[model samples]
Target chain A: MFGNIDRHTYITLSCVILEPNSPKISLARAGHMPFLVKQHGGVSVVTPRGLGIGLASAKIFDANLEEFSLELSVGDSCFLFTDGLSELQNPQSQDFGYEPMLDVLRSPASLSAQSIISEVMKSADSHAQGHPQHDDMTALAFIFKGTNKILSEYDSIPL
Target chain B: MNDVKFTIDHQSFGDVKLLKLQGYLDAHTAPHLESALGDLIQDGNHKIVVNFKELDYISSAGLGVFMVYIEDVRMTGGDIKLSEMKPKVFTVFDLLGFPMLFEIVEHDQIALSKFTA
Candidate 1:
């Protein structure tokens, strides 16, 4: 439908469906950045092949689209972000890039999902060096606490 | 003003049209690119090549412009071959699986050669 109405404008969608009370979460990406999985202090960028919406006919788009699944161990954190965050630039016109963004995901385990977002935003702001953002910036993050730990306001906070 | 400077330099090699893009391509500048591609398709010129050697930056919106025309051109026995994309520009395309859908060449001659060979 998008190819008919306005072919030039498109949307990137990243959907994570969590099975009830399970560490196994399924991810579907459509022309968006990959999701980050930080488990055991190692960062993995989970990129399932996907083309953005309105880029091709439904047949071709669906053919190329793929879904990925992974089981999260204790303290596994997953992060989703828009292209705006990684593409954020500083005064020198150099993009903040993925290396530093991944660095934020590698943060200590003491920090909750909330703090991860805060740390990334803070890092991006510092990298911007007073330059205004050029794109819509949005970030969402969540950590699997293994269904045993007491859920605090910080751990369960919806940001 | 949210505007960023973007320019397209056009050249014709036999049946193929080469468009050299320069400067930033964000939401503000995507329409200009869409119209340019639309005009080319309208003129019955589908064998196209886009040189990203000079393009400094591309946003998600800019990336969508290629999607708008790929199917239309491909159905008509032609294709849009992208060439000479800087590492940064190529990285953005790779992020969204564009390389699988489009032919990305390392040089303009390679892209142009694919049209005839």
Candidate 2:
């Protein structure tokens, strides 16, 4: 919606947005990567193929919007990261990929978004062994506690 | 690896300064370009013509930085323009769909003329 075909590289992007007052959170993917959702002792992967917007003649690719839901109790968390993290190559020239990522999640260390992201970056950096970040690194983790957990945490926030 | 070099020059076609980029705009070095443009925008110089005559490569993340700031630049009553992109970079641009949104020209003088006129 910004520019014509010859001026602006239009790589539109979309993601699953959780809204308030909705019965369930929604998930969508468009020319982007998947997000991780964790609940009830299990991990979920949500990735759909959508054309990267600005690629030449990428119109042939179809955009897909898919949703999956999980019942929540307490202490459930979701994680998301860009390829930079998954694709990070260690000093041994191997990727500190999904397995390590899952390991991090299994550990108790990945309870909060900031801590999870920081630890992942540190792990990747350590694996790289002083190699420059070949790509921009980004990560997001969301812990889903029940409504009671939300209220309790909210009540504790100092005004 | 230092295929592209950037420099800032003040031109008085009428009364504006021109900050020019003469290098590859790719992932490996785009952070510097982003910061340069960022500083200029922060300093309130909105009108810009990125002379891409010497530009060699650009990646999606590199493009993202521009897309991220384009709104801010336009909001300030300034625009980002392009000129003299080598065919190599243009191919990258065309492949990525950037040509559709940017003002790309074939010559540096033409880009400057557009800014003045």
Candidate 3:
């Protein structure tokens, strides 16, 4: 029932759909920042161009929208965040930026997702030099450990 | 520093409604924005351009307001456009991937013209 509205007033979002016990993840983008995946001592940014939800007609949005699948192995991790983390400014008014964040992601493979997230947040806070936060900082780190063999074994037991 | 406060100014360019925002847009101020946008939707004025030149900051909560309303406006054959965001303010939206969902222009005039196009 909606008519043609202006496109400027839309918001951007990124969503990841994961199947239980499956390594494959389906990601949909709506003008959000790229998520990063770390594997084999290398980090790759997943940035698929897509229009925002309200910026175009349904047909146009569908035509431009992209969905991609990723298979993660054990010890692989993905980092998702809003700009507040990378854009945090210091006393010199310099932003923390993306490079340092990539460096933070270079943590040892043995580190858990929680540990990596802590390190990332700590680094961002230190970079701020005690300046009061100007924007909200949010992030999610997903570390794949493959299928839970122990749980599977338990499931196989007669109950 | 001044305690964070937000204010909205309503203006019109023919059928397009413009809301100029000043100050920070965080959880506290997000409700005000939602109320303002809601009022516009109620009045059937869907063409909107939110000028953020005077806005100093935006949090995720502020961003959520746009997400909540965009679809409703679109369903009614109208749209909301954003314009004149400061680099910092824009970064917040960008960090959350808003550029993909919204048509962000550098100027109010540009956003205004999109309605005609």
Which candidate number has the best DockQ? 1
Q: DockQ of all candidates, in order?
A: 0.64, 0.03, 0.15
Tell how far residue A24 is off in model 3, in angstroms: 8.4
Clashes of each: 0, 14, 24
CAPRI rating of model 1: medium
Q: How do all the candidates rank in terms of DockQ, highest first?
A: 1, 3, 2
- Candidate 3 residue B82 Cα shift, in angstroms, is 1.5
Decreasing TM-score order of the candidates: 1, 3, 2
**Clashing pairs in model 1?**
none
lDDT of 1 at A140: 82
What docking tier does model 2 reach?
incorrect
lDDT of 1 at A90: 89
Fraction of the real A/B interface contacts present in each candidate? Answer: 0.67, 0.00, 0.17
Q: What tens-digit string does per-residue lDDT give for candidate 1 at A1-159?
A: 554767566668899987657778799999888898887769988889898776667997899888998887777888899988888888899887777768887867436777887888888999999999987778888777775442323546665
Better of 1 and 3 by TM-score: 1
Ranking by lDDT: 1, 3, 2
State the C-alpha RMSD over the true interface residues for candidate 2, after superposing those residues. 7.4
Q: What lDDT does candidate 3 reach at residue B23?
A: 94
